[model samples]
Target: MANPNQEIKFTKLFIKNEFVDAVSKKTFPVSNPANEKLVANVAEGDKADVDLAVVAARNAFCRGSVWRNTDPTARGTLLNKLAALVERDSDIIANLIVLENGKTFANAKVEISRFAQILKFYAGFVDKYYGKTIPVDGPIFTYTRKEAIGVVGAILPWNFPVIMLAYKLAPAIAAGCTIIVKAAEQTPLSALYIAALSKEVGFPDGVINVINGFGPTVGHAIVSHLDIRKVAFTGSTDVGRLIMKTAADSNIKKVSLELGGKSPLVIFEDVDIDEAAMVAHNAIFMNHGQVCFAASRHYVHEKIYDEFVKRSAALASMRKVGDPFDADTDQGPQIDEESMKKILHFVDLGKEQGAKLETGGKRIGTEGYFMEPTVFSNVTDDMSIATHEIFGPVQCIIKFKTVDEVIESANRTNYGLMAGVMTKNIDTALTFANAVEAGTVWVNCYSAGAVAAPFGGYKESGIGRELGEEGLSLYLETKTVAIKLPYKN
Candidate 1:
């Protein structure tokens, strides 16, 4: 029988479809962010370990039969199989995610389901990938062929570990590229579970490897590895810039970054106050407000500002905070104490700047990294929380008079990953959607995304898209092969 309190130890790393001890033999404890308790022990891989994984992935891409020569239909079939496997083990994955990442169990299950959905979506597109032949003037025939970029390196964040994992992995596999993933140190169990499932689904040895360790060590190593042909990263803008620099210095590998955001939610006066207020509540509180696209900044029309603030504050105070495993828990603790401190620091800065805290600007209880769902009114665009990616359950509300001012405030941030507009007017909705400098604009909705549509950041939020045909392109390289026509013009 396993020890109840002791975390299960994963002494080996996943490489070549099997578990092997890390070459460096370093190890680290995986802790539950909710209570700061150990949940598991994962190999702490570094440069040498990353090199080994990269070589394994490169061989899998270049010499192995797993993906390089697989037919598109066959590739799709494998991805479909993987999706089914994920669905079957959704509960297990969700439990692990909650245990380590501190997200509510309900939200974790939804994330798992979303992961499966993305896998299925990529599977659908695998068979649909086609090379186009363009009709050109004269005897010249122009054609394009898409081929896999080998040995993709995927660096995931801890916030939505498994879901983000699916976002990067599914499309890469569908495009016939072997991948090596570095899971966030804060969460590693789900990645291990995913590795186990990959073997069960018959992905060949070395095709998909998962490494767990610190970013500077494992992440940098993977990004700088010569064998890595591409890098797909989801993290902070600072880290994204570092990865870009590393990739540039070592190799001209393709880089895809989905970075941070201080997304805005615009609530026009024409919208239903009740409906808009409720929508805005979910916008800032979902996932404990740890979402990259969480509507952290709110721009409300002055006409309904008082009512909106009142309703939004009431909803924030009503959120149930407890262990992530509890079904009744609406929100869990921040990822860890460090993150909790960072969030509180931002909240303090909000106070220092003279922003009025309507409610919830302090930690909730002493048991965990539990922060009260905070809301700040009278916030200026210049406030740090108003401009930075707080990545917490803090909502900053700002009032605006005109549509043009609202648009300007919404677009003022350096990050433009997503923005929300709560307006019943179709004309206003369309106008905001068109004018907002964001990759995704939600009308009376927040964080609404599907695999059919492409997702990315417009400015510093990110480089490269993550879903649909555009996402798949990140994993593929275009090859134009031509031969002289039988009869020249």
Candidate 2:
């Protein structure tokens, strides 16, 4: 494996604006998935560390605290400063992401750049979040004002650590809420680096604290903490459900979850077969198919299904699977051994169930956690491979006859995170886009989204939205103020 241009190392928890060792004195080794080499031994945070971080966040959000008392415009200025810092150190952050998360170096840079953009996007909203005035006939004057929702707990996922951190932190900080971030143990380096940069940007102590640890300890503590008024999580649906239950049982905290997806990509007969195949390939193969919104299920019109599958399989076969740091590598290893095994298991089950394995389905090499970009054709909706989320680089292609039929098949799963429709017919595009039960539907495109666009799920995929104006609302609450004039004039 090619080493990053710069050496990046972080081995401590960031709490109250300072790097500190965990109270438990325990640490876990973070490995580079591309080469299966130890990256660093990071401080392992548990309930005790979470308690301390939560207390600090609670104090920072309390009345008269510097973070709580800062004006919205000033808050925006701080966020912008942090954004600038991030831009200055973009290369290092990107390198850390590649080293820890095993995404391609180029993709890591894109994520870092987008991280800064998201910060700037939320920074713009700091001074723009407004309240409303209700018109009344009586002498009483009433108005509603938006207020920060105190302390927030953000549990990030390993797939896109820095980007997810930006998604949760930018909005919460923009809304004047203090946050305690729990970085996934598998990829905590970039997050801790971000916390270090936050300290340099002069954000008040405890306004942003990052803990590095596993889910059951640090993650559970953050969700159940009474002082954490709001919780934003991005991970599996099973974990999201657990967070919801914990929040309800503990303090009824406001919760937002961006969870798993068995999203579909529908291709109508009108589109160019080659172009549709390429789009479908990237939708599932990007990020080694570890994306929450990856298009796992593909439905093509019966008229063009054969051509689409042929082109898609050819493209998947040509993809360069190797070390993430390799300049020409099109795909990297899965996050770890567990994920690799799980995906291969699904591939095996698909074959046993009579699904045709079209292109690739085996481990690539003896070392690391790499797998061939697998594709299965003639997949039925009820097949486990078609139904479950095989989060690795595997695609399932099924044939459909009509738009209505595809829509029914697409929405068959409980997930509603995202979907894509490819067609030249405007009516067909609109029909599929309108009928699909997903949160975001792309027409003639796949996985296209922006910071200004609201993104989330509709059904078991998730509970609340993230990104855009709706995301800002997740970190805030509303209170009405009333004034009554003495008697009638």
Candidate 3:
């Protein structure tokens, strides 16, 4: 039933399972970054729209509502139904993602495929989520109950739209919480389409809502609203800080953020140079280097530095950079012109600060926002590229002498999202993995995460985890209930 050739269009705000226009009757153009052409004119939601969405979510989360009082197994069943619908429309969703986000068609399909798996993963937790019984003294029985944390406000990023939506929405819904999602203005089509699919799947009214607009107006309203009990955001660290501040200043709402990363990949001299080169190339160049946990910082042992750089450069040159919808394309344009300009600025800074440009440091074509897959050698910690979170296709390779030295150098930056170590010796691999300051460390691998495993950051990268059992806990609150029984003879 999934039709890859079906034409899809969404041009309104989806609130309370209904498509409606904005209160001000204003609209903004959604452009296809692949060709820099107009896709649709979307309703521009503001604070007024956010207010209505929050109210709907609050009502749905109330004590006697259909959503809040539903049986746990029934809730799981509904989630499974939603997953089935996602599977049925995966092709359409993937094509819409390609049209708006500019990721290669294969990558878009991969993201869409994960939607069902993620939803089912969380759905399994619906009845399994339990609290422990405690032994108390005398005539009292004590235990704790895990309850849903009222209304959630989810703010998604432009990159990986449908996957991120599954990460936030699936867990929240499984935990019996209503949500008001604010899709990134740059890529709102796929999320709106998925919302429509949810309505077809028969979710209760006011259970799932979505709106599109600028961050300052729509996003700010979601974080600052007093009725919103929890706020989950995935974006830049600067904006994450603003959300935290807004939450604290308003009503002290619970917050979870998955922010930026400047993760490092360490390669030892013992491994096969060919395999290391391939992994290193895929780590940074897989998603046009736009991934949060991308191994942008490469720390190679001095013995294999030259050979690794050579192989990586050769692969970069062979990459197919063109339109996203093309099946053969390996790389596509950046999200927009602003992102292209920012990435180019960092490329210039890397050169000015004395790093050697190895290959692919300029724009690819005259149209769209495509940039060359860039690599820089002789990069030191002091360089601008090495110090900042360059969310683009720019790799910085630094040479190191020992595990201790590389560990210190890799932990020098403020980010601690993810780090990778590739080696054959168990002691060496475990040593580096233990020494690094990151939330998740990969040994002999990179950027391969699962829905069953918890993923998040350490320091500035984020506040809480997003997947696995821990992810479900983020949407739930525990309350201790003690009942006093009549004294027995």
Candidate 4:
């Protein structure tokens, strides 16, 4: 095993904007997926720590001037300052993400850049916030006010910790809401690093708190905390459901979940076959297919099904996998051994269920949590790989004849997070985009969008949205005030 003490660095938790020892005094190993070794120690917090953090956030929300009737321009300026700070430290954050999350350095940098842009976008929204005017009868006057929601609890995922954190945090803070963010245990380094800078950027001590610990303990504690007025979570459908149940039973805090996805990529016969094939390749391969909206399920037209599979398998095998720090690295290890094992289990289940594995189906080496870029052909809609969110570099191709058939196959799963359509025909693009049961549909690209676009899931995938104006609204509550206007003589 890699030296746990040498690789991991953090030894404390960031609570109330200060690095402090956990009440439990327990430490967990931060593993580097690059070589499957112990990197450093991070604080192991539990319910007591959660309570303290929640109390701090609640008090801050109720008492701090930073988030209470503060100047919108000032809020925007602070966010911009933080964005600049992030840009200046982008390399540091990128390196931490690569070390702790096991994505290629290039991808990590891009993710960091995206995160920065998201913060900037939310900051831009602060000054443009507006309410509504209502016409009143007689001398009565009424108007609605959009106010910030208090004490937001953001539960983030490990796959893209920094980027996902931006997805939830940027808009909430921009809208003048205090937050207690729970970082994923698998990849908490970048978040802690950012927590440090958040203080440096002049956010009040308790305005932003980060707790690094296990999901069931620290995470559950944050969710169940009575003082938290809202919960924003990004993870699997199972966990999102659990959060919903917990929130309902507790404070019924407003919740927004961006959960799991078994996304589909539909290719129409009218589209250029080769172009569709290449797009499909990128759709499933980018970020090693760990994205929430990875086009894992490919619904190719029956006329070109065989060619697509052969080409996709060839493309999957051509990917480069090596050190995450290397600029040339095309793919890196999964977050950890457990995650690799889960992906492997899914692949094995696919084989057991008679889905033909076309190419690349095994662990790559003894070092790290690397798995071969896998592509499975002849997949039935009901196959585990086609239906479940594998969250790895695995692609399952299914055949379809018509638009209706493709739509049906795409919507078969409980997850409806996103879908992609590659078609030259205008009718096909419009039909797929309109009919697909997903929160976001990419016409020709997969996982392509600006921070201005609202991202979320449909059906059991999740609730609420993130990014753009919708995300901004999640952190706000609307109220109306009425008064009697002076009568004109």
Which regions in candidate 1 have their CA more than 4 angstroms from the true location?
Answer: 1-11, 63-66
Ranking by TM-score: 2, 3, 1, 4
TM-score of each: 0.96, 0.98, 0.98, 0.96
Model 3 alpha-carbon miss at residue 99, Å: 0.9
TM-score of 2: 0.98
Best by lDDT: 2
Q: Across residues 268-311, which tens digit of lDDT does each residue of candidate 3 receive?
A: 99999999988999999888888999999999999999988888
- How accurate locally, in lDDT, is each candidate? 0.87, 0.91, 0.90, 0.85
lDDT of model 3, residue 487: 88
Q: Candidate 2's C-alpha lDDT?
A: 0.91
True lDDT of residue 192, candidate 1: 84
lDDT of 4: 0.85
The Cα RMSD in angstroms, rounded to one decimal, for candidate 4 relative to the true structure is 2.5
